[model samples]
Target: MSYYSISAILTSAQKVPCTFDLPIPNRGFLDDNPGGDIAAHTPLPLPLYLAELLAVQQLDNRPLLTLDLPSSLQPRVLNALKADAKSVDLRGQEVYFFEGAARVLELLEEEEVGDGLCEAFKKRAAEIADHARNARGGTSSGEGGEFLRGLDEWERGLFRAAHDSSKAVRMWMGEVKGAK
Candidate 1:
């Protein structure tokens, strides 16, 4: 992702669960307390960027914080995606679901989660392409409407690209026939 990409910024801003490995003074505001110390092992929701930085910082050869999978990539969500990737509302889970997951996976190294996400993206991409190609008059209704509404930002871009390309191809074919 580019440094100036809006999607990268949004993905970095998404919060992830992190547990402090050591007590820290005057950082309790992270856990909703002010002017107090944060105890060791206190779980807090921190931005992905901050959490990743803290988790990578070493204190006595150990990481300062342990990063946990964000709620969006938790087992329940993964199971739902595994069951039916197209039915899961990825937008509801996170606007930048795949990007955020990629970042978290970099820190946590959860191979299963990576596999699940890849599978989900593959399944959904096929569905998105089908919908994009078959959509009538640039409008979606019924099941297609609901599915389109559930697409994350990246998937929406894919759908738009697919839809536009399908239209362009059709126009080109019409032009070719006319010339014949």
Candidate 2:
């Protein structure tokens, strides 16, 4: 979540569903009705950064907006992750799924989503590590290829690090054996 992290910037651009708690003038462009006032209780898909900012702002001791969970963290997706984290196409759902979820959770504080994401990441990390260690010069096909293709930005980084580490370990072992 650093200021210059590309992932953070992308996550901030993700859209989250939010409802306006109070009507505001000259804000209908957000709902595709430019030059008009946004009606109270109007639901709109706003970028995470704007939504987070408005959600926390107090207008007469009431929040300006109510942020809802993004579609990526909806119940159906969570259920799929819970059932089989390896099977879920996180990249298809969102390229920065985990990072965006972390941001949204910070605003909404949903324990279930947090727990589900942690469990899914743990399960998928083990699978990713296995694939990384056993990879044969990117020759994976069929199921493995499909799974690898579905990895999000974070998961892809994890896969790359794990793969490189495994390769390094193999190289180190070879050097040690040759030294003996």
Q: Which candidate number would show the highest lDDT if scored against the true structure?
A: 2
Per-residue CA lDDT of model 2 for 1-180, tens digit only, reads 799998899889988999999999998888888899998998899999899899999889988989998889999999999999999999999999999998899988799889999999999999999999984933489998899999999999999899999999999999999999
Model 1 per-residue lDDT tens digits across residues 97-179? 88889888998879989998999999999999998898482357887788889999999999899999999999999999999
Point out where model 1 deviates above 4 Å. 135-138
Model 2 clashing-pair count: 0
Q: Would you list the C-alpha lDDT of every candidate in the order shown?
A: 0.90, 0.92
- Summing lDDT over every window of 10 consecutive residues in candidate 1, give the lowest-scoring window: 135-144
| Backbone clashes in model 2, listed as residue pairs | none
- State every prediction's TM-score relative to the real structure: 0.94, 0.96
- Model 2 is weakest, by summed lDDT over 10 consecutive residues, at 134-143
* Candidate 2 local distance difference test against the native: 0.92
lDDT for model 1 comes to 0.90
Off by over 4 Å in 2: 137-139
